[model samples]
Structures are given as structure tokens and as C-alpha cells.
Target chain A: MDRIPILRMGDFLLVTIQVDMHDQLAMTLQDDLTSQIEKTGAKGVLIDISALEMVDSFIGRMIANISGMSRILDASTVVVGMQPAVAITLVELGLSLAGVQTALNVDRGMQRLRADVAGKEADDGRHQE
Target chain B: MAVTKSEVIPIRTEHDIVVARQAVRRLSVEAAFGLVDQTKMVTAASELARNTFIYGGGGTLQCESLLEGARRGLRLTFTDQGPGIADLSLAMKDGWTSGSGMGLGLSGAKRLVNEFEIESVHGQGTRVTITRWK
Candidate 1:
């Protein structure tokens, strides 16, 4: 019954992974995140992984799946706060997380999301006019 | 060189994979490996533990702490009685997976450690050994 909480902050959903997630927990988070995005109509997702010391291929793939699903649902995902060691291990593990965007920290991630949403809205307004 | 200390852990389910990672991390830290080295070892352990559970059906992990001369190292040996791999050369290739995984488990784990070895018998089982020296 352990679940990672998904917090909605205005137009974005913020997920801070603080535990050493097992495979089931990672899968559940993916499902919960997509459902939350649909229900809230969020435009962006920011995943904080600073607290995670290790990231294996399974967890890396889960992040990619979440990003891809969010993209299809009209949302952008930014993975932030990856530890230097974790990043090195991920690259060595051959999981580049191809389609997902990353930032140095949560503050920068939020700024990036805000700008992305604002840009999308501007494009939409132009199309309407 | 002989291992100064060793412990054996079972890999039966998903939860065991997490435990395996923690054990590897602890051993790597105790060996005085840097943060990057510890993370690499732990990540490799996670991949192998999952492989043991999902592909091998179940297995045992032996973690050993080694002291060779002035160098310290951590070594892990995973053995499973499941159906053995028929094509080791192909399995070691990147992006080659018999399961739903990204196929990076074997090759990726190899890249993370300083030494890697694998043995399999067609009908018997598989054994993988890896070591990282600090």
C-alpha cells in the first residue's frame, strides 16, 4: 500500500521520489502520474530524484515511460535533481533517458516548465487568432 | 587473494532487489570506494538481482569484501538454477534481451565493474561474478 504521492502545483504535477523504489512502486508511480495528469489537465511534470542514490535500468525506463506518456497526454516532463553519481551510473547503464528533459535542480526545473507552458499557450493563442 | 568477509542473500522477489542494492552499497562504502564507484556497483547489483528473480526464477547472491595488498574491493556472485542462456555471445551484446527489459542488464553490469565473468550450462544453471576494486 506504499505509494509515492503526486502533488499538483498549478499547471504542473510535482513528484519527488524519496525512497529506494522497488519495481512495483515504480510502476505504480507511473500509473498514478498519468491518471493525475489526465484528471488535473496538467501541462507539465517535474520529477525530483535527488534523494535517490541508485538508478537501475528498470527505474530509468520507468522515467522514460512516464515522460513519453505525459507527452502524449499534452504535458512536458522535466527530471530534476539527479545526483552526480546517479547520473554517471545511468549513463554507464546505457540508459540515456532519450526523450526526457533534465535540470540541475527543482528551482531550475520549475522555471523551465513555466517557460514551456507559456510558450505553448502563446502558440495556441496565435493559432486561434 | 581470499575474501576477508562475505555474506549470502536470497533473490526471490522484487523486494529482494532493493535489499541487494542496499547490501552492495554498504559493501562498496566499506571498501572505501568513492560515491560514483558505490553507485555503479549498486546499480549493477540491482540489474543482476532483477535478472535473477525474473529470468532465473530465483537465485542466491554472494557478496564478498576483499583486501588485496593495499587495494580493497567488493565482489558479487549471482547463481541461479533456472534455464541457462544458450547464446552467451549474443546475450552479452547491447540491446539483446530475452525478457521485457531494455537488455542492458548483462552488458551494462559489465561496464560498471572492474572485473566480470559468466558461466552457464545448457540445462543446469547460470553464474555471474563481478568485482570492483578501490
Candidate 2:
């Protein structure tokens, strides 16, 4: 059976989820990824979900959960390479993700992460003012 | 307990899930909840509404605004009159599906929202309530 792969990129972590993304597998993937992000203290995380064809409510919720939990851990999360069909379906299903960040590619997602970090640092500097 | 307006939408067929989910999301957005809460409520309602049409043959989705002092949230109640689940425990288990189902409906819904509850009898019917707070 294929397994989810984790890649370390600088202070960021990359998680490649290779599965049908159905039922419990989807939920388990979210739970495990969240725990890993918390354990590693990574600055940011990237998720590649391009392999998924159909995303039911389970997968949508899992993605939302991961993004939400990562915030508590102080790690920003970005999802990359989501299929257009999946995006369309999510909108149709009313799964709008406002708190989570998303990008069309990993590079863009990383850029966003860097920007977030930079912005946070700038905010902190201002807070000291 | 935060009390808000409740809307009851009748489900006549499988297509009604789309409408039900849309209504729930719109209400969540209008109530000033975050996108995550809206996502959870929508996904949970999708599962329950699908169950209503596929298993219950038809039902209704009741959406109510939730507020707890300064906090805000939403709740969805799905009711169906079709054949109720035979075994709730087995149905909750992963990969144990009935009628070509992927078997993630109920359990997935539960995980999406902060609060979830379900009640059903073999033939009486099924009622599922899910809530997400902002």
C-alpha cells in the first residue's frame, strides 16, 4: 500500500499525500499531518493533493481541520496543486476556506509562507513600538 | 445560549442536498462567522442531507443561528423519514458501507464540526444535528 510522504524543506515541511482521499484515510491523514507539524515546530507546511480525483465532504473537512490546527501550533499551512475540478466542487459544496492559505503551486505557496513570516515579524516590530 | 432565527427547508429528493448546503453556508456567512466554521457546517450538512435523500427518501434541514454571549456559531438539524440505520455503530465505523456508500457520511460529518449528535431507529427515522462555532 502506498503511504503519505514527508519532505523537509529548510524551516518548512512538505507533505505529499498519495491516496484516494476517501473516508477514514482522509481523516487520518489530516490528524497525522497536524501532529507532525506540531512535533517538528516547522515554520510553515506544504501539502500536495494533486493525486486526488474526488473530494467528498470528508476530505474538505480534513483540509480545514489541518489548517485550523496548524494555526494553534504556530505553523502556517498551504495547499498546493489542487485540481480545478476539486476547487469547483469545493465551491459548489460551500466549502470556503477563509482562514487557510492556498496556492496553485508549491513555489507560490512557499512564497506566501515567507511573506507571512515577514509580515508577522514586521507586526511584532510594530508591536514593540 | 445565543438564539437566532431558524429556517426549515423541505427536502423532496436527492437534489435537495445542494439547496440545503447552500442555505446553511449563506446563513453562516451572513451571521459573520469565519470561513472555517462555514466550511464545517456545510460539509456536515452535506453528509446529513445526502443521507436524508439516499436513505431517508426525503426530509428537512433546519438551520439556526448560534450565539453564546460574544461568540457566534450555527447549528443544522437534518431529519428524514426513510428507513433508519440498522446499526449506528457499524455505520459509524470506517469502510463499513451500505448500499455502495463510501461509508464516510456520518463519521465525516461528526469530525467536521465541533459538536455532532445523531438519533435513529430501524424504521422510525433519523435525526442528525451538527454545530460549528466561530
Candidate 3:
């Protein structure tokens, strides 16, 4: 029942997803975050899937969508803290993320987000020259 | 022992995704492989399943185990009778995605497996083949 939390860490946006591992809830949460990515335009988004016990196709595609759309919206996104079981399941199902950036922990994801934002900003500045 | 196993599993909804994962795991475990091979196969299958359902509306996943003279491996084939890919090359490129994919479906699957092939015809459907070994 607890919704995903979106917090701004400097220029980056951290999304803390508290999952119940329930199928229906995972679907709901994924939909909610997908829309949030569009509405907030946060520079960076991090998803904490540590509490998640399982992720089906719907949720998997939704996560992929979130990361995909975030780029279109000019925001960077990373998935953090996936359990070994969940990671293994994802691999077996061939749902392994191709473009979505993932980090071992929330801190590392945030650091990467910060770096990504800085790199993009630097690129933009150089292009303006 | 030249024992070959092949079956076409359907992917209708999200639950089917779990079944697909299980099938792949069983195949990998039966071969007595390590975590890396298992992980790669699983990851590649996951992306293909997602693509089949999302883009193809629904489809079938075919898995074949090849054990030819001590060379043990598995081949995964995903087929969908949905709208075929318009641009195969671009779709395979990283960061290029259709619908909600993170632009990693095809390319990501490619990296996870030893061999990858995709055949599609516009307005027809798609067939993706991937292989992994012990």
C-alpha cells in the first residue's frame, strides 16, 4: 500500500520504492512511477528494488519504460539494490536490462546519477561553444 | 549421449514470464553449468519474453538443448505473430527503443548470449534465436 517515494538529491532525483513483493502492488507501483517520471522531469531517478521478492513481465517492462522515458524527458535513471533471487529470475526470463543502468546500491546509483548529470551538462556547454 | 530437447512455450501474460524463467533455469541446471552461464541465459530470455508480449501481443518461446558429442548447450527461440519490426538495425541499437523498452531488449539479449539472430518481416512477425553453453 505504500507508494514509491521520489526525492531530489541535489540535481538528481532518488526514487525509493518500497515493494511488498505482491504481484498487484508491483504492477500498481510500476504504473505510478512511469507517470511520475513524465510529470516530475527529475534529472535522475533511482529505484530501490531491495525489498522486492519478485518481478514479472509487466513490472519488468514498466521499469524498462521508466528508464526509457526518463531519457526522452531528459532525465537519467538507474535501478539499485536488486536481490540475488530477483536478479537471477530476471536473467532466466531473459528480462535482463540492456539499456537501463543499474548500480549495486543506492549510494553508488546516486553517485552515477550525479556523474551522468555533470557529464551531460558539460557536453551541453561545449556544444554551445 | 545425443539427447535433444525442444518445446514451444506460450507467452500470453505476465505469469507466463515466470514459467519461461523456470524452464530456462531447469535447462541450465540440468546441464551442470555455473552461475555466469545461467545468468546470461536467463537475462537473454527475460528480454525476449518481454519483447514478445509487449510488441507481439503474445507469442511462443521455443527452447532446444543441444548435446552433440559432449558439447552441451541450449538454444532459445522466441517467435511472435505481431507487427514485425520496422527497423531491425535501429531497434538493436542501444538507447533506441520502441514502446517502453530501455533500448536494451535486442542488444541486451545479444550481449548475454554467445550467439544471437533475429529474423523479421514487416507486418508479419519476428523470430529471435539465442544460444548459450556450459
What ranges in model 2 sit over 4 Å off? A1-129
lDDT score, candidate 3: 0.77
Winning model by TM-score:
1
Across B1-134, the per-residue lDDT of candidate 2 in tens digits comes to 96678889998764476677778868988778665556556666777887887788898888988789988888888898888989999988755678666566787677677888889999889999888788
Please give each candidate's TM-score: 0.99, 0.55, 0.61
Sorted on TM-score, highest at the top, how do the candidates line up? 1, 3, 2
Clashing pairs counted in every model: 0, 1, 12
Best by DockQ: 1
Clashing pairs in 1: none
Q: Estimate, for each residue in A36-122, the C-alpha lDDT of model 1 and write its tens digit.
A: 999999999999999999889999999999999999999999999999999988998898988899999999999999999999999
Q: After superposition, how far is residue A12 of candidate 1 from its true place, in Å?
A: 1.0
User: Which parts of model 3 have CA positions greater than 4 angstroms off?
Assistant: A1-25, A30-129, B1-3
Query: What does candidate 1 score on TM?
Result: 0.99
Span of ten consecutive residues with least summed lDDT in model 1 chain A: A90-99
Runs of candidate 1 with Cα error greater than 4 angstroms are: none
Q: List the global CA lDDT of all models.
A: 0.95, 0.76, 0.77
Candidate 1 lDDT by residue in tens digits, B62-134: 9999999899999999999999899999999999999899999999999999999999888788999999999
